[model samples]
Target chain A: MTGVETLIAERSASATAVIPDIAHYLLNAGGKRIRPLITVAAARLCGYEGQGHLALAAAVEFIHTATLLHDDVVDDSALRRGKAPANQVWGNAQSVLVGDFLFARAFMLMVDAGSMRALHVLSRAAAVIAEGEVRQLAAARQIATTRDQYMDIIAAKTAALFAAAAQVSPILAGASPRVEAGLEIYGRELGLAFQLVDDALDYGGVAEALGKNTGDDFREGKITLPVALAMEAGGEAERSFWARTMGEGVQGPEDFDEAVARLKRHGALDATLEQARAHAARAVEALDAAPDNVWSQSLAALAEFVVERAY
Target chain B: MTGVETLIAERSASATAVIPDIAHYLLNAGGKRIRPLITVAAARLCGYEGQGHLALAAAVEFIHTATLLHDDVVDDSALRRGKAPANQVWGNAQSVLVGDFLFARAFMLMVDAGSMRALHVLSRAAAVIAEGEVRQLAAARQIATTRDQYMDIIAAKTAALFAAAAQVSPILAGASPRVEAGLEIYGRELGLAFQLVDDALDYGGVAEALGKNTGDDFREGKITLPVALAMEAGGEAERSFWARTMGEGVQGPEDFDEAVARLKRHGALDATLEQARAHAARAVEALDAAPDNVWSQSLAALAEFVVERAY
Candidate 1:
C-alpha cells in the first residue's frame, strides 16, 4: 500500500500546476482502492516478491481515477465520494484534460513495469472501459435496456479493469496460463459483484455509507439493473412513470420515492443483490486454481465484502 | 495512402454503434491525413516493405483523431474540418468517450506492430501530447506567455507525435539508431513548422484555405507565437486591449479585427512565418543521415508544404 501511495504521488506530480492538483485532489479523496488492492494481491498470490507490483498497482489506480474523473463529467455529477467532484472544482475541460494526463501516466507506469503483456492487457481494458461508458451513455434514460445489456456495460466499464489488474500480475510473475486465467475470472466476477451492489444501494442503501444521495443514479437517468428489472415487471402506469421521469427527464422531488417503491414492489433491489451474491460466489470459486496463500485468502474475503455493500 | 485508409477503417470499426460512427465521421471528414502520411512515409523511407507500417500509420492517425475530438470539447469549438464538430452531432460525452476509444485502438495497433520500441515511442508521444494540451489550457489567454513557452507547447502537442511517427518506422525496420534519430529530428522540426504556420494563419489566413475559420485561435484566446510576439511589441494601449479582450474574455465582434490589425502592425505574422521557415529548413536538414530514397525526397518536399501554408 505504501508502495502504491509513493508511486502514485510521484507519477501524478506534474509541472502543470492544475494537472497534479486536480489529479491528487480526486485521488486523495477517500474511496476503497479496490482495483489496486486486487492488482497487488494477485501479484502476491502469484509469488511475485519483487517491487514491480507496486508500479502495476499504482498504474491500475491511475486508470481507475482517470475514468472516475471522466465519468463525473459525463454524468454531470457535482459530487464524488461525498466531496465536490474535480469537474466542480476545476471545470469540465480541466477535469477531462487531467483525466487524460492520468491515463498517460498510467501507461507510463505500465511501461515502467517492463511487461508488454501487462501493457497490452491494461491498454485494451482502457479502451473497453471507454466503450462501456459510451454504451452506458447510449442506454441512458432508455427504459427498455435489457439485463444482458446492463451486464455487458458493467463488465466492460468495471470488470475489464479489475480483470486486467489481476491478470497482469501473473504475467509479471511468469505464472502459468491457468493461474493467469483464474485470477482474471476472479477479478471479473468480483468487479461485477461490486458494481451490482453499488447499483442496488442507489435505491435503498444509506446515503452516508453510499457517499452520495441514495438516488444519484436515478437522477442521472442511469438505466441500471434495478430500473431495467422494474420496467420489465411493471404494468402500463409504471412503464409510463419510468419513461416520464428518466427518459423524458421530467422529475420532481417525489419521483425518487416513487422509484424506490416501484423497485421494492417488483423485488428489483433484492433480485439485484441476489445476482451480486451469485457473482461473489463465482469470484471466490475462481481462486480454485490460484496459489493458496494469505493474499488469496484475503481476496476470497474481499469478494464477499463486495456484495455485503448491499446490506 | 490507400493502405493507411483501409487499415484505419478496419481498426476503428467497432461493434459499439456510436464509437465507429463518430470516429469515422471525423476521420472521413476532409482534413489532410498529414500525421498518418508522415508515418507511412517514414516507414517507406526506412525501406520497411512489409505490411506492418499500414497498421502503424493507421494507429498514428487514430491518436491524432482522438486528440482532435477531445480538443474540440476543450476548446468548445462548433466546427471541425469545415463541418459541425462531433460534439455538436453526438454531444460532448460521446465525443470524449469516442476519443478514448480511438486512443485505445491506437494502442492495440501499436501492440500489433510487433515492436516494443514502437509502442514505447508512440505511447510516450501520446502522453506528451496530452500534457501539451493541458499546458496550453493553463497558458490560454495569458498575455505574458513567452515565445519559448509557445515553442515548447507546439513541440509537445504537435511535433512529438510527428517525431514519434517518423522514428517508429526505423525501429520497425531494424534500422540503425542513427537513422531513427535523424527521422525523429526531421519529423519534429517538420511538425514545429506545421504548427507555426497554423498559428500564423490563425491571425490572417483565408478561412476556406485553412478549412476552419481564421481568428479561431484568437477567438479561443489561444496565446500562440504570433499573439505572444505582438503582445511583446505593443505598448500600453495595445496591451490593455489584449488584456481586456483575451485575458478578460470581453470580446466583441470588432475585437477580432482589432487583433488582426495589431498582429499586422507589429509584423508578428511575418516573424512567425520566418520562424516556421527556419524550422522547415531544419526538418529537411535532419535527413542528412537517413537513406536517400524517393520517400526521403517526398518528405523534404512535405516539410516545405507545411510552411507554405503561411504564404
Candidate 2:
C-alpha cells in the first residue's frame, strides 16, 4: 500500500497543472482505496514478494479513480467521497479530460508492470465497465427491470474491475490457473456484495454514513435492486407510485420517505441485504484456494466488512 | 483503408446498443481516414509485408474517432463532418462514455497489435492529447495566447497522435530506428500543417468545403493560431473588438465578419497558411531517411495535400 501511494503520487504528477490539480483533488477526497487493497492482498496471498504488484495496485486504483471522475460527470453528481466532486470544482470539461488522462495513465502503468496478459484482462474490464454504464443509462427509468438484468448490469459495471484487479495480481505472481480463477471469483462476489449493500444503503442507511445522499437513486429515477424488488412485490397502487416516481421522474418532497417506507413494508431492503450476505458468504468461500495466511484471512474479513456496514 | 474500415466496424460493435450506435454514427460520418492512411503508408515505406499494420491502422483511427467524440462534447459542438454531432444526437453523457469505450478499445487493439514499444508510444500520445485539450480549455477566450503556446496546444491535441500513428507501423515492421524517427517527424509536422490550415480555413474557407460552419473558433472563443497571430498584429481598435468578442464571448452577429476582415487586414490568415506550408515542407524533408519508393512519395504528396486545401 505504501508503494501504491508512492506510485500514485509519482505518476499523477504531470507537466500540465490542471491535470494533476484535478487528479489530486479526487485522489485526496478521502477515498477508501478498497480496490487497491484487494490487489495488494491478493498478490501477497499468492506469495508475490516483488514490487510489480505495487504498480498493478496503482493501476487498479487509477482505473477506479478515472471511472469515478467520469461517473460524476455522467451522473451530474453533486458530491463524491463526501466532498464536492471534481466536476463541480473543475467543471465538467476539465473533469472529462483529466479522467481521460488518468485512464491513459492507468494503461501506461499497466504497460510498465510488463505483463501483457494482465494488460489484456484489465483493458477488457475497462471496455466492459463502459458498456455496463451505457446499459445502466438505458435502464435508468425502467422500473420493470428484472433481477437478472440488474445483476448483469452490476456484474459488468462493478464486478468486472474487481475481478480484474484481483486476477491481475495472480497473473503477475505466476500463480496457478486455479488460484487465479478463485481470486477472480472472490473479487467478483465481493464486488457484487459491495454493490448490493450500496444499493440497499441507498434506501435504508443514513446519508452521513453513506457519504452521499440517501435516496439518490430514487431522485435520479434509477431502478436499483431494492426498488426493483419492491416493484415486483407491490400491488397496483405501489406500481403507480413507482411508475410516477421512478419511471416518470416525478417526485414530491415526501416521496423519498414514502419510497423507503414502502421498501420497509415490503421487506425489500432486508431482501437486498440478505442477497448481499449470500454473496459475501460466497466471496469467503472462494478464498479456500489460497492458504490461510494473514493476508488471505484479512481478505476474507474484508468481504464481511463490505456488507456489514449496511447493517 | 478497407481493412481499417472493417476493423472499425468490427471493434465498434458492442452488446450495448448506444455504444455502437454513437460509435458507428461518428465512424461512418464521412471522416477522411488520414491518420490510418499514414499508418499504412509508413508501414509500406518501411517495406513491411505483414497484416499487423491493419490492426495498428484501426487502432489509430479508433483513437482519432474517440478524440473527436470527446472534443465535440467539450466544445458543445452542433455539427461535425457536416452532420449534427454525436453529442447532439445521443447527448453528452453518451458521447463521453462512448469516447471512453473507444479509447479503451484503441488500447486493446494496440495490445493485439503486439508491440510493447508501439503501445508505449500510443498510450503516451493519448495522455499528451488529453493534456493538450486541458491546456486548450484553460487558454480559451483569453485573447492573449502566444503563438508558441498555441503550437504546443495543437502539437499535443492533434500532432501527438499523428506522430504515434506514423511511428507505430514501423515498430511493427521492425524497421530501423532512423526510419521510425523520420516518419514520426513527418507525422508531427504534417499534423501541425493540417491543424494550421484548419484554423486558417475557419476564417477563409467556405462553409461546405470545411464540412462545418466557418468562424466556429471565433464563436467558441477559441484562441486558434490565426486569431493569436491577428491579435499580435492588431492595433487598439482591433484589440478591443477581439477583447469584446473573443475574450468576453460577447459576439454580435456581424462580429464574425469583422473578425475575418481584421484577419485579412493583418495578413493573419496568410501568415498562418505560410506556417502550414513550412511544416509541410518539413514533413516532406523528413522522408529522406526512407527509400524514395511509391509509398514514401505518396506520404510526401499527402503532406502537400494537407496544406493545399486551405490555399
Candidate 3:
C-alpha cells in the first residue's frame, strides 16, 4: 500500500504546475484504497512474489482517482473524502484536464508493467467504466429505472474495475486460467456488494463513517437501489413525491428528510442491505476455487468487512 | 479514408444511447480529418497492404474527435465545425462522458490491431496530450508567456499525437527503426506547423473557411504563438492593453480589433507564419530519411498544404 502511494506521488509529478498539485490533492486525501488493496491481495493469493503488482496497484488507484475527479465534475459535487472537491478548489476546466492527465499516467504505469494481457484487461475495463457512467447519466432522475438496470450500471461502473484489478494479478503471477477466472468472479461479486452498501448508505449511513454526507444521492436525484426499491413499493402519493422531487427536479430543503422517511417506511434501506449481503456471500464462495491460503482468507474477510460498514 | 470512416462508425456504435449519438455528431462533422489521413498515408508509405491500417486510422480519428469534445467543454465554445458544440447541445456532463467513451473506443481499436508497440506509442501520446492541455490551461490568460513556452505546450498538446500516429504505422508494417524515427519527427514537425497555423487563423482567418468564429483564442485569452510574439514586441501602452484584455479579462467589443491591429504592428502574425513555414520545411525534410516513393511525395505535398491554409 505504501509502495502504491509512493508510486502515485512519483508518477503524478509534472512540468505543468497545476497537474501535479490537483492530482496529489486528491491522491493524498483519505480514502480506503480498497481497489489497490484488492490487486495486492489477489497477487499474493496467487502465490506471486514480485514487484510488478505495485505498478498494477498504483495503476488501479490512478484510474480510480481519475474517475473520481471527473465524477465530481459531472455530479457538480462540493466535497469528496470529507474535503472540498478538486473542481471546487480548481475550476471545472482544471479538474477535467487533470483527470485526463491522471488517466494518461495510469496507462503509463500499466505499460511499465510490461504485461500485454494486463494492459488489455484494464483498458477494456476503462472503456466499460466510461460506458457505465454514460449509462447512469442516461438513466439519471428517471423513476422508471429498474433494479436490473441499476445492477447493470453498478456492475460496469464499479465491478468492472474490481474484476479487472483482481484478474490482472493472476495474469501477472502466471496463475492458471481457472484461478484467474475465480478471482475475477470474486472481485466482481465483492464490488457489487460494496456498491450496494454504498447506495443504501447514501440514505441511511452515517456521514462520518462514510467520509461523505448522507442523502447526496437524493440531492443529486441519483436513482440508486434504495430509490428504485422505494418507488416500486410506494403508493400513488409517494410516487408523486418522487416524481416532483427527482424526476421534475423540484427539490426543496425538506425533500431529503422526507425522502429518507419514505425510504424507511418502504424498508428500502434494509432490503438494499439484504441484497448486499447476498452478493458478499457469493463473493466469498467464488474464492473457494482458489488455493486456501492466508491471502485468500483475508480476501474473504475483506468481503464481509465491506458489507459490515453499512451497519 | 472511406474504410477509416466506416470503421469509426462501426466501432463507435454502442448499446449505450448517448455515447453513439454524441460520438457520431463529432465524427460526422466536417473537420479536416488530417490526423487519420496521416495514419493512412504513413501506413501506405511503409508499403503496408494489409487492412490493419484501417483500424489504426479509425483509432487516430477517434482520439482526435474525443479530444475535440473535451476541448469544447474546456474552452466553453458555442460552435464547433460551424455547428453547435456538443457541450452546448448535449450539456457538459454528456459531452465529458461521451468523450471518455470515444477515448476507450480508440484504445479498443489499437488493441484489435494486435501490436503492443503501437499501443504503447498511442497510450504515451494520450498522456502527453493531456499533460500539454493542462500546461496550456495553466498558462491561460498570462500574457508573459514566452515563445519557447508556447512552443512546448503545442508540441505536447498537438504534436505528440501526430508523432505517435505516424510512428505507429511503421511499427505495424515492421519497418526499420530509422524509418520509424524519421516518420515520427516528420509528424511532430507537421503537427507543430498545423497548430501554429491554427493559432494564427484565430486572429485573421475566415470563420466560414475555418468552420468556427475567428478571435476565439483572443476571447478565451489563450496564449498562442501570435499573442506571445506580440507581447514580446509591444511597448508599455500595448502591454497594458494586452494585460487588461487578456490577463485581466476586461475585454470590450472593440478589443479583438485592437488586438489584431497590435499584432499587425508588431509583425507577430507574419512572424508566426514564418515559424510555421520553417516547421513545415523540416517535416518534409525529415521524410527524406525514408525510401523515396509516391506516398512520401504526397506526404510532402500534404505538409505544404497544412501551412497553406494560413494564406
Please name the candidate that would achieve the greatest TM-score relative to the true structure.
2
Residue range B170-242, candidate 3, lDDT tens digits: 9999999999999999999999999999899889858888888888888888889898888778778778988
Worst 10 residues of 1 chain A by lDDT: A205-214
Clashing residue pair totals per candidate (backbone < 3 A): 0, 0, 0
lDDT of 3 by residue, A1-311 (tens): 78888898899998778888999889988889899999999999998898889899999999899889989889975468888889989988888888887887787788778787888899889889999998888888888889999999999999999999999999999999999999999989999999999998888758876778887777777899998888899878888999988888888888899998999999999999999999999989999889999999999999999999998
State residue A215's C-alpha deviation in candidate 3, in Å. Answer: 1.1
In model 1, the runs with Cα more than 4 Å from the true position are none
lDDT of 2 by residue, A89-157 (tens): 888889889999989899899889888888889999999999999999889889889899999999998
lDDT of 2: 0.90
lDDT of 2 by residue, B1-311 (tens): 78878899999899898898899998988888999999999998898888888888998898889889889878976568889988888887898889989998988888888888888899899999999999999999988889999999999999999999999988999988898899999999999999999889888857787687787888889999888877787777778988999999998888889899889988999999999999999999999988899999999999989988886
Candidate 2's DockQ = 0.82
Model 3 reproduces a share of the real contacts of 0.66
Q: Please give the ranking of all candidate structures by TM-score, highest first, separated by commas.
A: 2, 3, 1
Minimal lDDT window, size 10, model 3 chain A: A76-85
Candidate 1 lDDT over residue span B1-311, tens digit each: 99889888888887899998999899999779998888889888888898888888899999899999989889976468888889899888998899888888888888778787788788788878888998999898887888999999999999999999898889999989999999999999999999998888877757777677787787788889888888889878778988888888889988899888889999999999999999999989999889898999999999988988677
Better of 1 and 3 by lDDT: 3
User: DockQ of each candidate's interface versus the true one?
Assistant: 0.69, 0.82, 0.72
In model 1, what lDDT does residue A127 have?
92
DockQ of candidate model 3 = 0.72
* lDDT for B141 (candidate 3): 94
All models: lDDT? 0.88, 0.90, 0.89
